[model samples]
Target: MENINIKQSDGAASLAKVYAIANQKGGVGKTTTALTLGEALTREGKKVLVIDLDPHANASVHMSYFPETVTTSAHDLFFDDADFKSLWGKIVKKREWVGFDFVPASIRLSELEVDLKDRKNKGMVLSNSLDEVKEYYDYILIDCPPHVGVLLVNAIVAADIVLIPIQTDFLALYGIRLLFDTIKILNKVLPSPVKFRALPTMYDGRAGACRKILNLIRRKLGDKVFSTVIHMDTKFREACASGRIIFDVDPKTRGAQEYMQLAREIVRNENA
Candidate 1:
């Protein structure tokens, strides 16, 4: 884990690796993982960028961003002539339990699809824009919109990796396969070369249904899934409401402990 923080020149400040934290379906803790992991990565001394593509601006709101005040959003990136490089300058450096920085999403992002549909390179707009600022952070986590559209294609095109957060519920059981199929089609048709893995969130071991979902997911995905599970905890809510990472809010809490473990797993996977 220390080795990952040593800065091996994989290009945290010079080259950015875009990771799309996506799932077409909603309520999967997608934003939660983005905030917590970004926080953990920052704590490990890695610069992290979070892009909010969801119109709800949940990530932005969770980060204490007031949509009324934010003029530029992901919508502007796709429409406005302002160089996307300038977008990097708009980054609102957050004060979090972890020291990582983030670029917030605005409520106006919902206008992205309708705004970019007429453009020729609409699907690749995000990727082209990110090229100008890819070198500033080690990780660029994009929180995708929860539906299939031009916005989603843009996100898929921009990502080198996709981390899907699957909820431990019966509803999520079928959605996983559907999401994978969508990814496959995107790779085949949209031609976005992206790799992906599943990370179970809001895990509850006490529930028999939860255990069933976990076992089924592991049985199918094998080691592609993360080893550390994010358990349901009160501290997570407190941290999210406060725009702080779980560990920053309460290092001894269940949510905080699992996130730290998840951070180590991320490093290990990168090393392997």
Candidate 2:
């Protein structure tokens, strides 16, 4: 790992905390964390923008925005040769709830990796696009894909902080080394390298193996690991199935409370 620093630009419209929820390994609750944290932040009176960069568009589906119905999406943001401001206007879809907006992803994005693989400034596309409406958001959260590719690279490049949601399992940690290596390479090209924190998710306190993996992750990452751990709960899947935020489904549940704590922890980490 290399030393990373965050640079605050004066040109930013609002001091939005740009976070990319990324992990090379799938099934680690990346989308779940992104949506939950975004909603939690909104409850705290912060305006949040969630960008679904995954072609699967689970976050969008969870929010009830079907890909077939979405006219302008993240695919347009990346592939359409239009001015970012204009594209931003076209792509951003406001949620029924105030203070939350998102750029849904379409299956077309799966084809984008090959389309822009040869583009000179492909990695910077997302960063430039988000700058157009940065002032309107207090936090910009991107739900990245499960693999390292052009899309993932764009997300990492655009982010101020890369939040890795790791499940409390050995398999989830298997390929994280590759993710760190990718970050190190990308950071070398950035003026201010993006900082990262590994968050342990889907933890089951009763499972000895889960607890062991969490401890092992802490030992390996040390301070790079967040203090807040998201324990596994059935509420996450239930909330997603119901298309409601965990807070709305069951605010008093441990799952909801943990997500709220994670949101606060992120805010404090950013300020620190």
Q: Give the whole-model CA lDDT for all candidates, comma-separated.
A: 0.75, 0.84
What TM value does model 1 have?
0.88
Distance from true position, residue 269, model 2, in Å?
Answer: 2.4
Which of the numbered candidates is closest to the native, going by highest lDDT?
Answer: 2
Instruction: Give the per-residue lDDT digits (tens) of candidate 2, residues 1-272.
Output: 11112233455555677999999888999999889999888887677889899999999898777989877788988766567766777677766643467778898999987898789999998888777777767899999998889899999988988999999998998768778989999879889877899999999999999999999999999999999999988998888888888887789999999988988887776668
* Deviation in Å, model 1, residue 61 alpha carbon: 1.0
Q: Estimate TM-scores for all models.
A: 0.88, 0.91
lDDT of 1 by residue, 1-272 (tens): 01012123453435767778888778888888888887777676667777888888888787766678766566667764566565555543445344666556677677766776678877888888888766767777888887877777788888887888989888986667776777878777664456887889888999999999999989988988988888899898888777766776888888877877887788677758
Off by over 4 Å in 2: 1-13, 97-99
* Model 1 global lDDT (CA atoms, 0 to 1): 0.75
TM-score of 2: 0.91
